[model samples]
Target chain A: MEKTWIANLLPQDEYREKRLLYFIAEAVFILGVSLFLYLMVESFIVEMDMPGDRMALLCIGFLITYTTLRSTLTGIEYPDVASEKRYQKEKRLRIYSTIHFWIIFLFISILFKGIPSNLEETFDIGGSATFAAIFFFILNYLSLKKSYKKNKDLLDD
Target chain B: MSLNNDRKIRNRIAVLRAEWNLSQKQLAEELGVSRQTIHSLEKNKYNPSLKLAFEISLFFGVALQEVFQYEEEEA
Candidate 1:
C-alpha cells in the first residue's frame, strides 16, 4: 500500500525536468531578442535622415516594450513557484526600466516644437535621445540574456 | 564527476511492492511523489532525491544500502 502510494506521486523528477525545459525556453527567447536588435539596427538606424531616424527609433522602442510584456505574461508555466517568482521579479524590473525609456523617448520625439533646419544642430538634439534609448534597451535586453544564461547553466546540472 | 562503479545494483521495486502487498497508487500517496515517479524509478530511468531515498528506506524498514549499493571505486 505504501509503495503503491508512492508510485502515484512523483514530484522531484518532474520538477527537475520542468526546470530544464524552462532554461531551454529562456535561452531561445534571449537569442531571439538579440537577433531582433541586430535587425533593427541594420534596417532602421544605419542610413536615415533626422526625421526618419526619429521615427525608426520610436518604432524600435515600441517593439522592445511589446516583446518584453508578451514574454512576461506568458512565463508562468516555468518549472516551479520559486522559478516563476524569480522570473517575475526580473521581468518586472525590465518592464519598469523599459517604460522609463519609452517615456523619455516619447517626450523628446513629441515635445520638441520643431526639428532644427540645420542638420548638425538637429542631430545634436535628436540623435542624443535616440542613442540614449538604444543604449537603455540594449542594457535591459542584456540583463535578460544574462539571467537566462545563468539559470540555464544551473538547471543543466 | 561521474559514477566510478561498474557493477549495477538492480531493483525489482515493482515486484517488491507487490510482495509487500502494495499498489502503485497507494505507494505514491504515502511517498508524496507521483505514480509516474514510481514508475520511472522502477524502470531505472530516474534517480530519487536524498529525502525520497530516506523515506523509502524507512518505509521498507531496510538500510538504504540494501536497496541501493555503491561498488568500491576501481583502483
Candidate 2:
C-alpha cells in the first residue's frame, strides 16, 4: 500500500523505477517543511529570537512556497497534449499564478513599507521581481501555445 | 529522460493500434500504462525501457523489430 502510493506520486507515463527516489524525496521534503514550519512559528508567532534575521525567514518562506507549488504540477499529460480543456486550464493557471505572485510581493513590500523610508528600495526590488515574473509568465504562455499546436499535429497523425 | 534526446526510436504503435481497433486509452489500460504514454509512443516523443518495449511487442503479438525500429543517429 505504501509502495503503491509512492509509485502513484509519479505521473502515469513516468518510470516505476523512480518510486524509490520519489519516496526518499518525499521523506526529505516532509522533514524540511517541518523544520521550516517549526522555525517560523517559533520565531514569529511565539516571538522567540532565532539565529537568523526575519529577512532570512521571509526568503526561505517564499522559496518554499514557490517550489512547493511548482513541484505539485506534473505538467500536461501526453493524451491531453492539445486538448482545449488542457490548454484552457494552463492559460487560467498562468494568469492566476502571475497575479498571486505579484500580490505576495506587493503585500510584502507594504509590510516593509511600515518600517523606514526604505520604501523606495523595497519597491525597486519588487519591481524587478515582478518584471522577471511577467517575463517568465509570457515565455511560458507562448511556449505552451506552440506546444498545443505541435501536439495537435501529433494527435492528428 | 528528456524529449530532446538526440537518439530517437521509431515505432508502429499507431498503425498497430488502428489495426487492432484499439484506442490509446484502451491500449494503455491493456499495457498498464497511461494514455499519455501511448500517445508519446505513437509520436516518438519517448523511448520506452527495454522491458516495456518487449511488453508492447508481446501485447501486439508481433516481433520486436516489427513494432520498433532503431533510427541511426544523424551525422
Candidate 3:
C-alpha cells in the first residue's frame, strides 16, 4: 500500500499523461547520465587527445540508444485489454526486428567489405553506425505514433 | 463517458468493484493489471480483449454479458 517515490511522482488516474511524464523523466535522466559520462571520458580517459566532434557523437549515440530502448520496451499498453497489449507487443517486435536486420546487415556488409583499414575508414564506419541508430530511433517514434492513432479510441481520457 | 460510436464497450466494473468491496488498486492487483487500467475500464475509456473480458467475468463470478454491454452502431 505504501507508494514508492516513482509511484508517487506518476499520475495515478491519467494513463496517457502518466506515460508521457514517465517518458520525459526517463529521457532527461538518461541524457543527464550521458552528459556526465562524456565529461568523465573527456577529463580522464581520452584527456586532451579526443576530438570534440567524437565526444559529441558519443553523447548523441547514447541518447539515441537510450530513447530507442525505452520506447521499444515500454510499449503502448491497454493492460486490461490482452489483445491490445498483444498487438502492441507484435508491433514492437516488428520494429525491433527491422532494427536488428539493418544492424546485422550493416555488420555483415562492413565485415565482407573488410574492417575499416584506416582512421578515416574507421570514422566512416562510426558515422554509418550513428546514422543507423538515429534512423531506427526515428522509425520507432513513427511506429509508436501510428499505433497510437490506431488505438486512439481505446486511449480516450 | 460519452455514448459515441467510439465507445464500443461499456462496463460496470466500477459498480461491481464497489459491490465486491475492492479498490481500483486491489482489483487491478487481482486482475494482474495496472491501477490505471482498472480506472480506464471503469470509466469506459478502454475495451478489454475477449480473454481479459472472460477473466474479469470469472473473477466476478458473473456472465460476460453482466460485466459488459456492446453497443454497435448501425451501419
Give the per-residue lDDT of model 1 (tens digit) for A1-157.
2345644533245533443445445655775687587678878889434476775676566665555444333332222222456766776777687778866775676467455668886676667666777777666556465545434433311
Candidate 3 on B1-75: residue-level lDDT in tens?
A: 765764377888988988999877678788776665676778777677577789899999999999998877435
Which stretches of candidate 1 lie above 4 Å from their native place?
A: A1-157, B5-9, B71-75
lDDT of 3: 0.67
Q: lDDT winner among the candidates?
A: 2
* B59: Cα error in model 2, Å: 4.5
Strongest candidate by TM-score? 2
Among incorrect, acceptable, medium and high, the docking class of model 2 is: incorrect
> What ordering of candidates by DockQ runs from best to worst?
2, 3, 1
Over A13-68, each residue of candidate 2 has an lDDT whose tens digit, in order, gives: 55323433454466557757977888889877896665677756765666554443
Off by over 4 Å in 3: A1-109, A134-157, B1-8, B19-26, B32-39, B70-75
Question: lDDT by residue for model 3 over A23-122, one digit each (tens)?
Answer: 7678779778867886798788886566879977876777666655554455443333324566667667766766786678579759876788899987
Ranking by lDDT: 2, 3, 1
Clashes of 1: 25
Ranking by TM-score: 2, 3, 1
